[model samples]
Target: MAKVTFKGNPITLLGNEVKVGDQAPNFTVLANDLSPVTLENSEGTTRIISVVPSLDTGVCDQQTRRFNEEAAHLEGVTILTISVDLPFAQKRWCGAAGIDKVQTLSDHRDLSFGEAYGVVIKELRLLARAVFVIDKNNKITYVEYVSEATNHPNYDAAIEAAKKA
Candidate 1:
């Protein structure tokens, strides 16, 4: 498992750690409408799966917004932000933030996505900050598990990987 910390304190992350060239794991998450969304739903396009602990926090909000802004320029790439935040909160945040390019998914109900991605922070029941770039064939092409839960990910690297994918 990748080492991670929250606010400088160590925390345990649960599940398998994914790597580049591996088949992207399929996990169910809830869309804004509370509908189930899985990895297969966007199989034909490249994807940037942005994982954050919560959208209510500063770093997470900026991370999602950065990806949302980049989504407009990355044609054929689908950007999805997954967080344990409830769908209602995600929807409300997106609306208030005017975030349209990136789709926000909720992983609060079951932590399916979090567990599959090996980003579930056990101590807090939130996901560690990370980013994944998967190709059109559903093969993961890039993976970044940020060392600190509250820090931002490598936006340029993630975006570049998505473009190449």
Candidate 2:
């Protein structure tokens, strides 16, 4: 597992850490309408999976917004923001923030996505900040487990990886 911290405090993360070139794990998450969304749903398209603890926080909000903005320029790439926030809360936040380009998914129910991606913060029942770029072939092209949960990810590196994928 990748070492991560939230607000400078260490926290346990559960699950096998993923690496580049590995097959992307399939996990079910809830869409804004509470519909189940799995990794297979976006097959045949490049993906930018943005993982955050919650969308209600400042850094998470900004991170999602940044990806939403980048989505417009990345043709053929599907940007997804996954968090432990409830689907209802994610929908509300997306509406208020005008985050249309980036699709927000919730892992609150089963933490499927969180566990599969190795971002599940055991202590807080939240996800650690991370980013994953999976190619259309379902192979991970890039993976970043943000060392600091509250810090931003490497946007440029992720975007570039998505472009190549």
Predicted candidate 2 versus true structure: per-residue lDDT over 2-107, tens digit per residue: 9888889999999879999999999999999999999999998999999988899999999999999999999999999999899999999999999999999999
Off by over 4 Å in 2: none
Give candidate 1 misplaced runs (Cα > 4 Å). none
Error of 1 at 99 (Å): 0.4
Every model's TM-score: 0.99, 0.99
**C-alpha local distance difference test of each model:** 0.94, 0.94
RMSD of each: 0.6, 0.6
Tens-place lDDT digits, model 1, residues 38-87: 99999899999999988999999899899998988999999999999999
Q: List the residue pairs that clash in candidate 2.
A: none
Superpose all Cα atoms of candidate 2 onto the true structure and report the RMSD in Å to 1 decimal: 0.6
